[model samples]
Target chain A: MSARATTRPGGRSARVQQSVHQAVRDLEAEVGRDALTVPLIAARAGVTPSTVYRRWGDLRELLSDVAVERLRPDTAPADHGGLRADLEAWAAQFAEEMSSTAGRTYIRDALLGDPGQGNAVRCSDYAVEQLKAIGVRAAGRGEAVPDVETLLDVLVAPLMYRILFRPSDLSTVYTDHLVAAALGRGPATPQTKS
Target chain B: MSARATTRPGGRSARVQQSVHQAVRDLEAEVGRDALTVPLIAARAGVTPSTVYRRWGDLRELLSDVAVERLRPDTAPADHGGLRADLEAWAAQFAEEMSSTAGRTYIRDALLGDPGQGNAVRCSDYAVEQLKAIGVRAAGRGEAVPDVETLLDVLVAPLMYRILFRPSDLSTVYTDHLVAAALGRGPATPQTKS
Candidate 1:
């Protein structure tokens, strides 16, 4: 049996995990990542220092968990009957999440900190999984699915770049263009809808 | 006349400016941005700390100048006979520069350090100018130049995203695809070249 299986579902252990994770995000938003400490996180979480230390070994480990949790999409990409609609929905959702306060903090830490860290790798993998689902759906319809890397380059990466370097509202118009480009349908039309 | 016009071309002042800029890049490569300091940079450049202070006034100013110089493409996107070739060449050069040690360091500092700073703004403007040149060239060729913002979203932003988040060799095939997508030509073929 797995270690996770030992814990009862929605029990005190789960409550504590949820609280601690929330505390980490709250503290990070308040103080920024550079000034955050284990003791600070413990105090904020209403947990003991020993508990924080034993559970997470170091600040990096704890941050990685918190970051990945916040960075992951709130819901999986929906199958919207066609590849274009599915991709547009996914892109729009991804863009919205990344523009949130928690998302921005997580991304900044992931990029500026060690690139080979668990958090960075986890985030990349998470994005790939989402893209893979879209590609699979596209293939099911017999539409030519763009390679995962190209999909990332044309659609996801640009939105992410804007999130970091250029702060702007992630519009439907922009996401549609990205989707169209990825699908090899050329630039999106003005009337393209999600 | 501007303050810049007062300095004789290729004189001692120019020599000092060049040496100091080179020193900043070399120091950043050796110790990374977080560890860098004015005294150390001045020493490396063989200029007195007072001289460094008197001219640039601070580390951020000095770093900004160095970064803008390195980040700016050595030459504007050449005509290359067609819009696709010109864009491919521009993207390739941009990707190569951002992959270099100095380019990586500059970008890290720009993103992590105060996002509202002059350095980040200057770099963004530099990129816009290069994109504008390509658009103007396309217009000259009687082709539809994608809107400047779309050009950035499709062509430039993805490459910047890759340079930071994913440290792979920036492929020519990838850049050509970006250009094709920007021009509304569709996904690039395997044989796509500059």
Candidate 2:
């Protein structure tokens, strides 16, 4: 038996992995996390159950992999020429992603699972990376970048809290306040309706 | 049959309700929400399955009732003679509650369950009430209270986000920063390590 499988791009193994990952996402979106099963995923992926077991070990492991992939920002943060603009754009994008069904399901599963699973850590790291990207852009434009941890505490954390706990639409106004608070602009004043 | 059930406190109906609610909490703490079952709850409460069905109709309704009860802060917000002090004390106490096993379990269940279930709203309302109490006290002392919505958006929301996402203990410094941010004091500077 050969010690290594095919190394070429778009090979059988690569195709199998892609299909399986897509299957997990589709099934999760359709039926939710609890209803997901190894056999169902394998069937959906057009692979054998043994293949799934050999590759990922179990449902939880497979789900964790999918989570890590999905939790990552879909695109690079846009450089908006200023710290406040960059931060607000990033936050607005993040809040939009989190409000989606797919995003919410992935986050909820990771959080509801065991903390030792490292899913939360992956999610946190993803946020940190996005923040770092924004910070780098700000520094390039000769701006004093705010502390990442402080930004997380003030802006990102509150946005996420509203997303998960309050179940409201992520308003641009809300994201703007978060940026202002992080920059020491003060608490976001509420807009009164005319 | 009479039009009304007994209105006396600690009557049979009251006893059954208390026992069932306690059973839900105990089971959730031990086995978690996913493992919870109506029959299991009935057995733990020492009530019949029929009684469980007749009283609450289903597991979700029972859980919602329990959630409403548990999410309410047990004690009133302390009147610490100042807005900042009162806010910090309240945040500290809330953070402590959220750090415990029971508190985390309750929050996780509420978040993971259906959003339309009203558990999250009850929890948010609890925080709002606590903030209102502090605001009233601040006004009594001739101190200008920050906008209630602003306080919720900054202080309460971020504290909750930290509780759910990050596994770290809530520090006094973090709570102080939230209060400061709400009061337009500035970004809370990190405390120096001893």
Candidate 3:
């Protein structure tokens, strides 16, 4: 990827980046992701194709950048007075967002052409930070909170696996079971296999 | 995707498939996946490019097919006298294989350009079949067996998630915890988060 002009203070470079990104989003929604091309995005952004290429390196990298931005949580995870409630709410919401068609596309785009795995790592870091916030909240309330990795293994992994593969049965029930398992409660009724 | 010419009995078509698949494997190892093209694969397989294109639709489809075949387990899940032991052994082995660089590449190939999700579903079916075999063996020995979906969500999901995203901690200990969780054992000492 090209050296991103990300750290520059507000100026023409940042404006151009914003316009190009907005163009990608607008074109993506209108024409869909599969049909997207650099020239079209540049044309819509009112920039030359060379400008887009020099900044983002390729379409995949540009898409990955957009996906990371989209995946960033808009707010802190809600606290529900207890770790179990907190986790159930968070897991359900996370699964619902990620299982959507657009969400899935962003995830695939984030992982694609990620030669250094930086995009994937950044996405994972977002999840880790959210989980840490929940953990801190639970610890403050004196509830015995499972660690973040434990939550990741028991809760997030199953949600993602189902979303990306067997997506037919992603529901509140499944997230509830994962929360229960992570809390050391026994397998609270295994999801019925189809 | 093109309508596959997969239904005819073993004949010229089967030979063509075998040769093409072998050519893909050989060329992927030699020239690397990114360097490959239909023309290169066709030339190596002693068939015309149109033959490959007609049968497989495109390079991504052909790669997906090869990945699914590579992912299929060659033998039954080994019986280890008890469900926990059985799952631990199988999970560890599965994690090891899927965490390898080659295995990760195959998985990515399997999922990419999978419009109907047939390739992804076939890979999931392989895991399901293996888990079912383990469950049946455990039940035959009077050991309580977790259902296939439970095994899938708890055991296979974490392994895959870790493999694809957070791969540094994929080890026997991680697989052991997943198996124990599926067996209703409490999270076996949460993996040391990196």
Candidate 4:
């Protein structure tokens, strides 16, 4: 459940969706992702298998739906005084979260069975929206910031490419380098975590 | 069959692998990806289902193997007179080839069920090798070109991100922009095909 769930607070449809989503999360933790089925999820949610089928069509789509919900950020990115510091902190945290095992799983799940790329767009939009907020904050403070697309190309894409295809090569040093490069700064200095 | 197949020219294992890979290609073209099964692939390859199971473990692994083979470039990137021209041409072609429907399918297949991430690494190595070749050519010509890692981050990553997640938003203009950015050039001027 996301902001949508809050809008339709008392709706039966929203309740069923919440219950089904909860069941999926519980079953994933209890058994694992591979063992999940519509009937099992429906049973756990106190709903009929037909209801699950009607709502989600199949296991893959259901998984995609759940993944999208999980990937939605709970809050706007934290403001860190200047645009450079704000972007650096955001990019560092983003790399850390997205490169994790569970994070990669969610990303893959979000893309699987996404024929229309709707789920993929939804996921990308989350990043886009967050970046836009950062840009707005920088502009308000009279600090120039790179456009959202530039940030995506220079920062987000590299992180995702590493997550999907070269997880072993990804490092905090690399993330810091990308943030610096995106801002048209000179060569990177390796960041030490506090 | 790749160069590996040539090394063991007439070996029984190589023969089996070639036949199986060929069968997968033909079947994929004929009946499509979703209808594929281990038994069907084995039958098509003139091998028993048990043989396929014993060799490949499952359909997903078999698909990954075929995808890796197909993703391997047939030849080294064609060199242009200058490093900038060579990189721009290569990036444009790479963007075109990878963003197609079949190409996207191959990428997905290569990644699916890849527990060891061996397939993913292999696919990445293909790009790495190509970029290295381009770099070598530039160095030979005494043209100071950007490093392969920079190309991967500023060029390949964006193409892949769009192909996997935001395909509709990707354009030739964007591809050209990435190449320019990677080369440390100013704003891109759109290229027209001859």
Candidate 5:
């Protein structure tokens, strides 16, 4: 109804903030980032442009927040034991991130063919660093260097490639198989749907 | 200035074609795909947008052509070994493409952060098919399948991820290392620079 909506909640204006954040995600998830604008986000969130600006700064910053949320890992119970547990946990996390509608959208949008190279370059560098950090964390627990790096690469690369390139749906079993293969615990087999 | 630079004899037209093509590439190389426009391309080429439109149709069509040329592999020498050679050859082709300035721009503009999903999906699918075709050919030559694919994936996926994430220098030596590592042909210490 209004040109824009800034719905913050709590006390004076926190309600407006929460409402507007939800609306921004909704607008992007629905029509996509290309279609989203301050005006549109404001309208959906039931707030004004000024309010949206006051809170989120700009569209890029808003999208960055959404992207970050989509990428946050959902940790699993660490009881599987040995590298398998770590591998499974990591692979499942990978699958979860790539398989989500929002995650997929974010990754898809972040690639080379989208809009801005500067943003793409920065985002890609950040992701690489994220992978590197994860690799370092694994190594702290006695994982070797090339071993740790290659292990991470093998466990996650296929899932990533599948998400990017193919229609074939990879499975948790495939993830497990890959981890097993990497750990020299089993053979690497090609996967079909679960 | 004849449009048929690549077609003319004495390699004169070839030079023109190379010059104009390089001009387009340089523009992409300098500012990347986001800042790429017919006006910018024309200015870079020291021509007019009318000339560019006349030569390459529209910007989309021109870019498509540029992408095709920039990425397609020149016929390289074949190996008599087996699937490993085939896979290496194929991966090397891709690595070379991704290493070029134009290729970097294409991937950065096409698949990196904010890469449009549809375009990324289409291109990545086409790339997989291309890899599959190479594998099939390798199989015909008596190369193994499961190992070949795994080896090939190990090589290509990392390269793709690097291209997607690095957005900087790419090199033939780097591809050679990927090929070596994936095939277990030699050590892969990750020769990073250049």
Candidate 6:
């Protein structure tokens, strides 16, 4: 992101940018992602079509800008003083985010390279990187296995897999199980060291 | 799934069915999955257009039947007694199957619901069900955690996500990561923990 990313050519003020952004967002809510056109975005923004095109080359570029703008740092999981709590909170939150209506829609459409935009992969990569960091944190604390990254995925991937591909019901029990598994406690009660 | 699934009304043997399937497979291999079509399939089958329509209704239906027909139950992940060994063998085999030229094209197109076939979702559902059974086996003698299913997703989703979305080197390392995660082993390590 260059400093000039959001700024218009003629020194447009923050106020004007906000107006345009708000209009784009309003159109997104009404028409969903597929129906969003530059003309419509301009009309909603109360600007000329030329202005919209000048600001962004195409719809894909505009969407990409929105993703970059909206990307934020993840809040760290609470210090549960134990790997289980930290991991459980992280897995549940990860599952919830991926399963959200918007998340699923973004992911589903993104998989197809629709509109020639690359936001889906970018966003998912960002999340995966964050999860890796969290795994590293847990490992550093000695509360988790050394290969916490792989362990974390094992503990969390089911929710994401089901969220994107399967029909598994996401429940509180599921969240707990994910937590337990991350802590080296098996998902099911075993007779111990078979 | 019936005997009639093969052969034409005009005394054509099931060999025609196999030939048509082989044609679809060849066309897919040559032109890639994104380019598969009804006419091409018929041409490959060495039959008149009417033959295909009568047998499978539309291109979508034809493709659906082809997909079902190609799915060899014995060819999927094997049952190797233990979760880790089974998953290791399965992941290696499954990855090879999916990453192959034909496998990639088919799964990618299937996900896109190409040919307008409604059975795409069903195919994905069936694979996930198979995955769930694999997960159940991972539980081995343990039964305490209920979200074991989500764990399954976490392990598998990343593999699909990486394969479908990114153009990175699909090395044995990534496969091992996915296989280990799916089996509830620590990250980056082959299924070390039982």
True contacts kept of each: 0.37, 0.55, 0.45, 0.65, 0.37, 0.34
**Candidate 6 Cα misplacement greater than 4 A, ranges:** A1-24, A42-82, A114-121, A132-148, A187-194, B1-87, B114-121, B128-155, B165-194
lDDT tens readout by residue for model 2, A1-194: 00112233887888988888889878977997679999999999999999998987778677766766677666678877788998988888888877776677677766655446377777877888889988988888798988777777777887777667665546787778778878877566545310
* Candidate 1 per-residue C-alpha lDDT over B1-194 given as tens digits, one digit per residue, 9 for 90 to 100: 00011123687788889878778777877997678899998899899999988988788667756655665555567778777788888888787777676577667656555445456656666788888898888899897767777777777787786676665556887777778777776565343221
lDDT of 4 at A37: 90
- Show model 4 residue runs off by greater than 4 Å: A1-8, A187-194, B1-8, B168-170, B187-194
**Which of 4 and 6 is the better model by lDDT?**
4
- Identify the superior model by TM-score, candidate 4 or candidate 5: 4
Per-model chain A TM = 0.72, 0.78, 0.88, 0.89, 0.57, 0.63
DockQ of all predictions against the true structure, Cα-based: 0.34, 0.46, 0.56, 0.55, 0.28, 0.26
lDDT of 1 at A68: 67
Q: RMSD in angstroms, all models?
A: 6.9, 6.6, 4.4, 3.8, 8.3, 8.0
Model 5 is docked with a DockQ of: 0.28
Q: Poorest 10 consecutive residues of model 1 chain B by lDDT?
A: B1-10
What would the per-residue lDDT of candidate 5 be over residues B52-165, giving only the tens digit for each residue? 777756676566545544444344335546766665666666677666655666554343322334445555645656666666667787765655346535666666655654
**Predictions ranked by TM-score, top down?**
4, 3, 2, 1, 5, 6
lDDT string for model 6 (A1-194, tens) is 10113444555546556556666667777887668888887787778878767766666566655644444334545566656666676666666666667555445444544333255456555555656666667678864453534443555445545565555556656767656655556534222110
Candidate 6 has a DockQ of: 0.26
Q: Over 4 Å off in model 5, which ranges?
A: A1-23, A26-35, A40-65, A74-79, A112-148, A185-187, A191-194, B1-86, B108-122, B125-148, B166-174, B184-194
Candidate 2 chain B lowest-lDDT run of ten:
B1-10
User: For model 1, what is the error of residue B173's alpha carbon versus the real structure, in angstroms, after optimal superposition?
Assistant: 2.6
Flag the better candidate by lDDT, 1 or 2: 2
Error of 4 at B127 (Å): 0.9
Candidate 2 vs candidate 3: which has greater lDDT? 3
Please list all clashing residue pairs in model 2, or write none if there are none. Answer: none
Candidate of highest lDDT = 3
lDDT of each residue in B67-174, candidate 4, tens digit only: 888788878888887887888788877877787777887888888757677898888889999989989988999988777777777888888887887754456566
lDDT of 3 by residue, A7-113 (tens): 44688888888788788888988998889999999999999999999998999899888887778787799988888888889988898888887788877777775
Alpha carbon deviation, residue A134, candidate 6 (Å): 3.8
